[model samples]
Target chain A: MATQIRELIGNHKILPVSMERVRDEDDLYELGMTSFASVQLMLALEEAFDIEFPERMLNRKTFASISAIDRSVSELVSGRA
Target chain B: MNVAVNPAALTTPALERMARVADEVAARYAADVDATGRFPEETFAALKRERLLGCWIPKEYGGEGLSLTEICGLVARLGQACGSSAMIYGMHQIKMSSLIQHSVGSPWHLDYMREAARDQLLLGSATTEGGIGGDLRNSICAVEVVGDRYRLTKQATCISYGRAADAILATCRRNPDAASSDQVMVVCRKGDYTLRETVDWDTMGMRGTRSEGFELVSEGDARQVFVQPFSEIAAQSMLAMAHIIWTATWYGIAADTVVKAQAFVKAEAKKKPGTVPPGALRLAEVSASLQQMKSLLVAGIARYEEALADESLMNTLSFIAELNTIKVSASQLGIAIAQQSLMILGLAGYRNAGPWTIARNYRDLLSAAIMINNDRILGNTSNLLLISKIDVSVA
Candidate 1:
C-alpha cells in the first residue's frame, strides 16, 4: 500500500523532488505539493484504492504527508470491508 | 440543504435604494470619472451616506445582512452607470465574503466585521503582487513574525483606490521561509499600512478604478491573520465570489447596452409610423444573446448559493469548471453585446456626445475578457476537465 501510494504521488507529479529522495514524514506542502496537485493526488488515490473520501477529509491535513495519506486510504479501504 | 440565505431576499427594499443611488450619483459622474482617470469619489460618498458600504455584514453585526444575490443586483446597476464604481463595490464585497465565510474561530475578524458595519470601512485587495504573474495563489513576500506582531512588504500590482480605502486585505507567505504556495490573508487597517505608488493606472477604461500599483508596507497584530490556509480560502470563497460578483457587474454592462440598442430601434420605428425599422431584427438578435448571458449568470449564482453549506462542494472540479465558465462566457457576451449595440446605432453610438453614445461601454466591456484574462481561466478549466467528469444534468 505504501509503495502504491508513492507510485501514485510520483505519477501525479505532486512533488518537486523525486519520491526516492522524499521521506514519508516530510510535509508534502513544504516539499512543493500545491493545492492543485493535491486534488489530483486525491483522485488518483481514490481510483487506486477504490474508495471515496468523505467531504470532511478534503483538507490540508488529510494530504499533508505520505504517512498521513497512507493512513487516510487505509481507513477508507478498511471501512469498505 | 443550505438555504440560510433565502434567494427570495434578493429583491429587498435595500436593493431599490441602492439602484436609486446608482442612477442619481454614479451615472451622473460616469463620464468625468472616465475622462479624468480618477476614483468616483462622489458616487462612493453617496453610497457611504446611505450606509451601503458595509450593508452585507450580517444583521448580528448591525448591518442589513444583504445576500450575495442582492449585492449582485446592486453591482449590476452600478455597472450600468459606472464600471469603475461597480468594480470597487464588487471587489470590496468579494473581500467581505472571504472574511465572513472563512473566519475560522477568530473573534477578531467578527469584531472587525461589526466595526466595518458601524464605521463603514471600505476594504481594499492586494492579492496580485509584482511577481506571481497573475496567480493570486502564489506570494513571494512573507510575513515576518516578531513577538506578537507580524509585518510584510509586498509589491502589489494594483490596489483599487488603495490610498482611500479604510482597510486592505493582503495575502503573503505564511512565514519568511514558507514556500510561495503556503499563504495567509492578513487584514491591515488603514493606519497599519502605507501604499507608495510604484506604477500609474492610465488606461482606456475602468480608468475611474485607479487600480494603481504600490509598494505596500504593513504590520499588525498576528491575530489579524486568517486561520485557514489561503488555498482553502481560494477554493471555497474567493473563487466563487470573485467570479460570480465580477460577472454580475459585467452582465450589467452588457444589459445596459441592450437597453440602448432597443431605444435606438424604437426611435427609428416611431419616425416611420406603421413601418418597422431595419434595426428591429438586429435588436431581436442581440436580445437573445443577453438572455443567454443572463441564463449563464443565473446558473452560476444558483450553484454558488446551493454550495454554501458544503466547503467541499465549492472546491469540487465540477463547481470550479462551471464558475469559470460563467466568467469566460459573460466576458465575451459583454463585448459582443456592446459591438452589436454599436452596429445598431452606427456613428451615433461611436460618438461620445449623444445619449446613444456607447463608446465608454465598448471600451469598458473590452476590459472584461482581458481583466483576469479569459485565456487563463479557460486554461485552468481545461486542466480540471482532464481529471473529472463534465457532469451536466438539468434534473
Candidate 2:
C-alpha cells in the first residue's frame, strides 16, 4: 500500500521531489504540494485504491503526507468491507 | 444543480429605497468626487444617516442584521450613482464580513463590531503590500510582539480611502520569524495607527476611490490580531465576499449603462415619427449582453450560497475556480458592455458632461479586470481547473 501510494504520488507529480528522495512521512504541503496538486493527488488516489473519500476525510491533514494518505485509503478500503 | 434559496430576504422595496438614497445623494456628489479625485463624503454621510453602513452587522451586534445579498443590492444601487462610492462600500463590507466571521474567540473584535455598528464606522483594507503587488496570500511585514503588546509597520501598496476610513484591516506575518504565508489579520483602529502617504492615485477612473499608497505604522494589544489563520479567513470569507460584492457593483455599472442607452434610443426614436433609430438595434444587443451578465452573476451568487452551506466544499478547488471565473467573466463583460453603451449613445455618451454620459462608466469598468489583474486570476484558475472535475449542470 505504501509503495502504491508513493507510486500514485510520483505519477501525479503532486510533490516537487523525486520519489526516491522523498520519505513517506514527509509533509507534502511543506515540500511544495499546492492545494491544486493535492486535489489532483486525491483524484489519483481514489482511482488507484478504488475508494471514495467521505466529506470528513476530504481535508488537508488527510493528505498532508504519503503516510497520512496511506492511513486514510486503508481505513476507507477496509471500512467498505 | 441544486438551486438554493437565498439565505437572506433582501426585498425589492428595501433595495429601491436604498437606490433612491444612492441616486439622490451619491449622484449629487459623484461628478465632483470624480473631478477632484476625492472621497464621496456626501454619499457616505447620507449612508451614515440612514445607518446603512452598519446594516450588515448581526442584529445581536447592535446592527440591522441585513444579509449578504441585501448588502450586494445596496452596493449595486450605489454603483449606479457612483462607482467609487460603490467600490468603497463593497470594500468596507468585505472587511466587515471578515470581522463578523473571524471574531469567534476574540473579545476585542466582538466589542469593536458593536462599536462599529453603533457609530457606523467606515472600515477599509490594506491587503496589497509594496513588494507583493497583487499577491494577497503573502506578506513581508510581521507583527512584533513583546509581552501583551505588538507593533507592525507595512508599506501598504493601496488603501482605498485610507485617510478617511475609521479603521483598516491589515494582514501581516503571523510572527516575527513566521513564513511569508503564515499570516494574521490585525485591526488598526483610528487612533492606534498612523498612515504616511507614500504614493498618489491618479488613475483613469475610480478616481473617487482615492486609493493611494501609505506606510502604516501601528501598535495594539496582542488580542487585536485574529487567532484564526489569515489564509483560512481569506478563503472562507474575504475572497468570496470580495468577488461577489464587486461583481454585483460591476453588474450595476453595466446595468446602468444599458439603462442610459435605452433612454437615449427612446429619445432618438421620438425625434423620428414611426421609424426605429439605428442606435435602437445596438441598444437591443447591449441589453442582451447585459442579460448575460445578470444570469452569470445571479448563478454565481447561487453557487456561492450553496457552497457556504457546505463546510467541505468551502476550500475545494472547484468552488475557488468557479469564483475566479465569475470575476473574470463579469469584469470582461463589464468593460465590453459599457463600451457598447457608448457605441449606442455615440458622442453624447463619450462627452464628459451630459445626462447620457457614460465616460465615467467606461473608465470605471476598465478598473474591474485589473483590480486583482484578470491575467493573474486566470493563471491561478488554470491550475485549479486542471485537477477539478467539470460538473455539467445547467439547472
Candidate 3:
C-alpha cells in the first residue's frame, strides 16, 4: 500500500520533487505538493483503491504524506472488508 | 441509450423573443460599447426585461428550464450582435449551471436560483486571483470564518463587468487552513460585497465586457459557501459549460463575419454585372471553415449533454480532456475563421465604423485564444493525454 501510494504521488506530477526523493514520512505540501496537485493525487488514489474520500477526510492532514495516505486507505479498505 | 438531437431544437419562442430584444439593443449600442469600454446596460436590461437571465435554472425554481443546447443557441445569437453581451450572458449561465447541478440539495442555492429567476440578477465571477497567475483551480485568498459568518477578501485579477453585476460568485480556499486548491465557491450579493478597482480594462477587443481587476471583500452567512468541492464542480459542469458556450459565442462572431463577407462579395459582383468578385472564392472558403467551427461546437455540446445524463462518465479524466480539447479547437477555429473573413474583405473589412467593416468582429474574435490562454489548455490536455487510454482515432 505504501509503495502504491508513493508511486501515485510521484507519477501525479503535483509535486515538483521526484518520486525517489519523496520519503514516506515527508510532508507532501512542504515538499511542493500544491493544493491543486493534492486534488489530483486524491483522484488518483481514489481510482487506484476504488474508495472515495469522504468529506471528513478531505483535509490537509489526510494527504500530508504517502504514509498518511496509505494509513487512511488501509482504514477505509479494512472497514469495507 | 444516448439519444442525439439537433441542439437547435432546444430554442423556444421565448428565447427567440429575447434574442430579438438583444439584437435591437446590440445594434444600437455594440459600437459605442466597444468604443467606450462600457458594459452593455441596454443589452442586459433587454435580457432582464425578457426574463432570459434564468433560462438555465429548472422550471421548479421559477426559471425557463432551458437545456444547455438552448442556452448555447441563445448565447450564439447574442454573440452575433455583440461579443460583450454574449460573454456576460455566457458567464452568468456558467455560474447558474454550476449552482443548479452541484448545489442540488442545498436550500440556499435553490432559494438563490429561485430569486435569480425572479430578479434576473447579473452575476460576476471572481475566480482569477492576482498572485495565482491565472491558475483558477488554486487561490491565495480564503474564506475566514468568524462565528456563524464567513468573510472573504481576494485580489481578483479580473472580474468581468464587476461594477455592473448585481451579485458575484467568488472562489476562495475552503478555510484559511485549507490548501490553496481546496477552495469553495461563495455567493455574494452586490450589497454584501465591496470592490476597489485594482486595474483598468483598456483593450483592443471585447472592450464592452469591461473585465477590470478589483479587490473583493465580502462577509456573509457561512451557508453561502457551496457544500461540494470545487474540483467536483469543475469536473462536472463549470469547465465544460464555459468551454461549450464560449465556443458557441465564438462561432456566432465568426458566422457574422461570414455574413458580412458574403454581402461584400455579392455587392462587388453586382457592380461588375457578370464577373465574379476576386474575393468570392475566399468567401466560399471562409464559409466552409465556418461550417467546421459549427461542427466542433455542436459535437462538443452534444458530448456535454450526454455526460450530463451520466454522473459517472462526467467525473472521469477522459471527459475533462475531451472538453478542454474542444475549447482549444473551437477557440483556434474562431480566430482563424475571423482572420479569413478579414482577408476576404480586404480594405472593406479593415475599415473602422462602417457597414462593410468587420473590425470589431475581428478584434473580438482575437480575445478567444487569450481568454483563458490556449497554450495552458493544451499543456493540461497533454498531461491528460499521457494517461488517457481511450482510443481517439476514428474507425
Candidate 4:
C-alpha cells in the first residue's frame, strides 16, 4: 500500500519536486502538493483501493503525507472487511 | 389569469414577476446600455425591487428559495431582453448558490445571505487572476492574516460590474504559506475594498456587462472565508451552476433571434399574397436547431436538480464529467443557432439598425465558448473519461 501511494505521488505532475527526495514522512503540501493536486491524488487513491473518503476524512491532515494516506486507507479497508 | 401551479413548485409568481421586469427594465435599457458599454443599472434596480436577486437563498434566509429550473427560466427570459444583465445576474446567482450549498450551516454565510436578501446586494466575482494562465482553481494572490482579520490584494483579470457591485467574492491562497492552489473564497463588501483599474471593458458584445480588470485590496473578518474546501465547492456547485445558468442565458439569445427571424419571415410573406418567402425555409431549419438547444439545456438542468437532491452523487467522477460535457455541447449549440439565424435573416440581420438585426445576439453568443474556453473543458473531459466507471451510453 505504501509503495502504491508513493508511486501515485511520484507520477502526479502537480508535485513538481523529484520523488527520490520525498520521504514517507515528508509533508506533501511542503513538497509542493497543491489542493487541486491533492484532490486529484485522492481520486486516484480511491480508484486504486475502491474506497471512498468520507466527508470527515476530507481535510489537509488526511493527505498530509503518503504515510498518512496509507494509514487512512488501511483503516477504512480493515473496517469494511 | 388562473395559471396552473405545481404543488411541489414555488416559482410561478416569481417567474411571472421576472418576465414583467425583463420587459420593463431589461428591454427598455438594453440598447443604450449596450451602446455605452455600461452596467445595466435599471435592470438591476428592477431585480432588486422585485427581490429576485436573492431568489436562490433559502426561505429561512428570507428568500423565495426557487428551484434551479426556475432560476434558469428567469435568466433565460432576462437574456432575451438583455444579455449583459442576464450574465451579471447569472454570475451573482452562481456565487449565492455556492454559498448556500457549501456554507449553509455557517452562521456568517447564513447572515450574509439574509443581509443580501434584505439589501438586494449585487455580488461580484474575482476568481480569474492575472498571470495565472486563465486557471480559476489557482491564485497568484495570497491572503495575509493579522490576528483575527485577513487582508488580500489580487490583480483580478476581470470583475464584471466591479465598481457598482455591493460586495466582491475574491479567491486567494488559503494562507500566506499555503500552496498556490490552496485557496479560500472571501466576501469583501464595498467599503472594505478599494479597486484600481488594470484593464478596460471595451468588447465586441455583451458590452453592458462592463467587465473590467482591477487591482483589488481588501480586508475583512477571518470568518468571512468559506469553511469548505475550494475544490469541493467548485466540483459540487460552482462549475455546475455556472455552466447551467450561462447555457440558459445563451439559449435565451438563440431563442429570441429565432423569434425575430420568424417575424421577419411572416412580414416578407405578407408582401406576396400566397407564396412562402425563401427565408421561411431557413427560419424553419434554425427553429429546429433552437428546439434541440432547449432540449439539451433542459436535460442538463434536470441532471443538476437530481444532484442537488442527492449530495453524494455530486462528488462522483462521472457526474462532473457529465456536467463538463453539457457545457461543451451547450456552448457549441448556442453559436450554431445564432449563426443559422443570421443566415436566415441575411441582409436584415447583417444591418445593425433593422428589426431583424441579430448582430448583438451573434456577438454575445460567441463569448460562450471563449469565456471558459471549450478546449479546456474537453481536455478535462478526456481525462475523466478514462477513469469514470459509469457507462454514459446507457441513458
Candidate 5:
C-alpha cells in the first residue's frame, strides 16, 4: 500500500513529499497534497486497486491520509457483499 | 473491459484534484470576483502550484500528459468555481495544444512548451478580429515576412486575459491573394506587442473574464510562427477535446446550481414548509438535467478519446459535428437548469451576496453557446445529417 501510494505520487509529479513522512492521521494538505491533488491520488488509487470509489466517499475525511485511504479502500473492497 | 488505456490519456486524477481546488476558490471569492470583475488571480495561483495548469501539456514537455477528456473535466470543475478563470484556462490549453500539434523541428517552440509545463507562461488566442464582425472575416491582421522576421498588426476582440496574458497566439494572413493559403497562427511574446485598452467588457455574464479588445503590431523572427496553415489533424483532435472540456464546465455549473439550490431549499423548507415545495421540485429537475449532462459529457469524451487514438477517425466530421450537438444540448439544458434554480432561489440569488453559485454560473455558462462558431457547429451538424440521409454511402 505504501509503495502504491509512492508510485501514484510520483506519477502525478507531486514531489518532495514521501510516504514515510505521511502520518496516519496527518492532514494530506500539510503533506503538500492540495485538495485537487488528493482527488487525483484517490483516482489513481481507484485505478491501481480496480475499485470504484463511491461518490459518498468524496470527502476530505476519507482521503486525509495514507491510512485513511487504505482503511476506506479496505472497507469498500470488503463491502462487496 | 480491460482495454489497456493509455495512462497519458486519462486525467481522472487531475480532474479530481482540480475539482476540489475549484470548490474552495468558489466558496471563497466567487461573489467578490463576479461583483468586482476582478481576475481570479488567487485561483490561478492555486492552479499553478497544483500543476493543474500543466494538465494537458504532454509528459515529454513536463505536463501531466492528460487526455482531452481529463482536461475538459478539470476545466468544468474550474468553471463551476469561477467561470472567467475556467474560460481563460481553456483558451490557454487550446493555444498550447495547437502549438504542440504543429511546430515541427523547432527548438524554440519546444523550449516554450517546456517552460509552459513548469512555471511556463500564460497564453491567449487573438483570433476574433474586431472589424471583421464574425468568424468568416478573413483576418485583417497581415503578417509580412522580412528575411528571418515577420511583422504583424491586427485587432483582437473577446481576448481572455488580454491585459495580463504573457503571450498572445496571434493569427494572421501572409498571402495577399484570397486564394492563397497563408493563414497562420503565430506565438508572439508580450515584449513585442502593445495591448490597446479599449476593452468594453460590460456584459450580463462572465464579467470576471476581463475579456476585452486589444491590438498587436509586433515584429518576430520566423521561428515565432508556431503553426502554418494553422490547421492539423491534432489541432482538429484538440478542438474535439476543447468541445468536451466546455461540455464538462457547463455540467459542473449545472451540478453546482442544483447543489446550492437543494441546500437552500432544504434549509428553508424546515422554516417555511409550504414555499419550499417548488424549490425542491426545481432542485429535482436541475438534478435530472445535471445527471443527463454528465452522462453525455462522459460518453462524448470517451468517443473523442477513442477517435484521438485512431488516426483514421479524423475524417469523421459528421461524428464530430454530432458531438457539437451534444455540447449545444448540454449547454442549453445547463443554462435552463441554472435559470430555474436561480428563480427558485429567488431574491437571495440575485443579491450580491447570494449563497447560490447559480447567480454567477447562470451568466458564465451562457458563453458556451456564443463562443466562436458555436451556432455554425449546430448548422454544420444539421447540414451533415441532412446530407447523410440523402447520400447513404457517406461515412
Candidate 6:
C-alpha cells in the first residue's frame, strides 16, 4: 500500500509533502492533489490493485490519505471493490 | 443468419432498413476495410439503401425527419462496426443536418438537399490546416461570396475520407469583403476541389482512417452558403453529436476488449498449476472497468436524450460539463481496457485474426479522443464549470 501510494503521489506530481508524513486519514487534497490529479490517482489505484473503485469512492475523502486509499483498495480486493 | 444475434440491429432499428443490413455486414467488413484503409463500399451502399443518410435532413426536404437521439444511436452503432465508415458517415450527417437547418430561402439549397437524400453522395469535413492549429470556429480558410456564388480556397489538413467522399464540407472564414460565419460549413463537390495528399499517417491507432491533408480550390458555383452562423451552431452541434454518436462505438470496442481479455485470462487460468493465473488479475480489472464504462455511457445517454427533448437542458452547465467528462472518461477507459487486453493476451492481441482484421481497429480506436474539438470540449467545459460553480454530475 505504501509503495502504491508513493507511485501514485509521484505520478500525480504531488510535492512538498514528505512520504513519511503521509498519514492514513490525511487529506490528499491538502497535500496538493488537484481534482485532475485525483482522477489520475484513482485510475492508478484501480490499475495497481486490479479492482473497480465505485462512483461512491470518487469523493475526495476516500483518497484523503494513504490509509483511506489502502482501505478502499482492500474493500475492492475483498469483494467490495 | 443469426437474426437475433445482435438484437440492437433489430430492436433499435436505424431510421432505415439498410442501416441494419450494414450493421450485419459491418463485423465482417470492418476487418478488411481497416486493413486496407479502404472505405466499406458495402456498408455505404447499405446506408444509402436504407435512407439512413436522410435521417438528419428535414422531412419537408426529402429526409426521414428523425430526432438527434435516433441519429446518434444509429451512427454510434455504425462507428462500432467500422471506424472509417463511421467517420465518413458522420461528416456527411453533420453537413446534411447543418445545411438543412441553416440553408433557408437560398435558391439552390433545396436542390442540394434533394440530391443529398436521394443520390447517396457522401460529405467530408476539412478544417484542420497543417501550420494552424485546428480551431474550426476561427478558421483562416477564405471564401469570397458574391451574390449567388462563393469562391473558396483552403489548405485543409488531414481530411478523413477525403478520397472517398462525394463532396467535401470545407469550413472557411468569409473574406473581409464578404459576410462570413468565421467558420461556415460549405458543400463542395469532388470535381470542385483538389486533393494533394500531405502526409501518410502511419500511426499506432485509428490507422485505417486515411486522414491525410489536402488542398481545396473551388472557383465556380462550388458551394451553397448555409443560412445559420456556423460558429455558434456548428460547434455546439458537433460537440453534441461527437459526445452522443460515438458512445455506442466506444461501448462496443470496450465490450469487445473485456470479452477477449476474459477469454484469454480464463484460458490462462485453466493451464495454471493451482494458483491465481497470471492473467486473472488483469482480466478482472478490465471487466470492472467495462462495467463502470457501461454505466457511465448509459447515464450519459440518458442525459443526452433529455437534452435532445428540451434544448434548454443544454443551458444547464452541468449537462455540458458531464458530456465532455463522459467522453474523456470513456476514451481513457477504452484505451486502458485495450492496453490491458493486449497485455493479457500478449502475442495474440497483437496479431491480426486474418490479413486485415483487428490489427487496424486497435490502431484506429486510439485516434477517437484526439480528433478536432476534443481539446476544445474539455476547455469549454472547464470554463463553464468555473463560471457556474456547479460540479459535473456523471451519474
Best by TM-score: 1
Better by TM-score, candidate 3 or 1: 1
lDDT, residue A40, model 1: 86
How many clashes (backbone N, Cα, C below 3 Å) per candidate? 0, 0, 0, 0, 6, 6
Question: What's the best-to-worst order under DockQ?
Answer: 1, 2, 4, 3, 6, 5
Which predicted model would earn the best DockQ? 1
Residue-level lDDT of model 3, residues B199-254, one tens digit each, is 99999999999899999999988888888877668767888989998998898888
For residues B1-395, write the lDDT of model 5, one tens digit per residue: 01222233344477766766687765477677778887777777666656676667788888878777677777777776777778777778877777676656778888888877666467876877877744522466667778988888778776777766778887766544422113567788878777776667877777777888877677888778765454342235445656766777677767777777888889888888566566777777777877888888887877766656764454344445557677778778878878877877888776655465366777887777886466776665664443222223423
Give model 5's TM-score for chain A to 2 decimal places: 0.76
lDDT: worst 10-residue window of model 3 chain B:
B1-10
**Model 4 residue B110 lDDT score:** 84
A1-81: candidate 5 lDDT, tens digit per residue: 755766677778553465565566665543445433655676677778778765446544566666777788888778864
**Which whole-number lDDT from 0 to 100 does residue B354 have in model 3?**
80
Off by over 4 Å in 3: A2-4, A7-81, B1-12, B393-395
Compared with the true structure, what per-residue lDDT tens digits does model 1 show for residues B152-234? 89999988889878889998999987778788899988889888999999998888889999999998998898888887788
Q: Write the per-residue lDDT of candidate 2 for residues B1-395, one digit (tens) a residue.
A: 11222223233344765676687989888889999999998788767766777788998998877777788888988899999999998899999999888999989999999998878899999999998998888789999989999899999999999988999999998887766767899998888899999999999999999999999999988888998888789888888888888998898878888999999999988999799999988988988899998777787778777877986677776678788888999999999999899898899999998898988988999999998999999988876555566657676
Ranking by TM-score: 1, 2, 4, 3, 5, 6
Cα lDDT of all candidates, in order?
0.84, 0.85, 0.82, 0.83, 0.68, 0.65
Q: Would you estimate the TM-scores of all the predictions? A: 0.90, 0.88, 0.85, 0.87, 0.73, 0.68
Q: Any runs in candidate 6 off by more than 4 Å, and if so which?
A: A1-81, B1-12, B15-24, B58-60, B104-107, B177-181, B220-223, B262-284, B312-319, B354-358, B373-377, B392-395
In Å, residue B118's CA in model 1 sits off its true spot by 0.7
Q: Write the per-residue lDDT of candidate 1 for residues A1-70, one digit (tens) a residue.
A: 8889999999878887789988889888866787568878988998899988765566667788989999
Q: Model 4: which docking level applies? A: incorrect
Tens digits of lDDT, candidate 4, B1-395: 11222333334488887887788889888888888899998788778877788878889988888888899999999999888999999999998888788776679988998988777788899999999856888888988888889899999989989998989998888888776767778988889999999999999998988889999999989888888867667877898898898999999888889988888889889999799998888988998888888887888888888877877567565677778888888889988988888887888898876677888888888899987899988877776555455444645
What are the per-residue Cα lDDT tens digits for candidate 6 across B18-120?
A: 3465458766687777666665777766676555666567767766677665665666566656666665666677666666655676657678877776665
Model 6's CAPRI class is incorrect
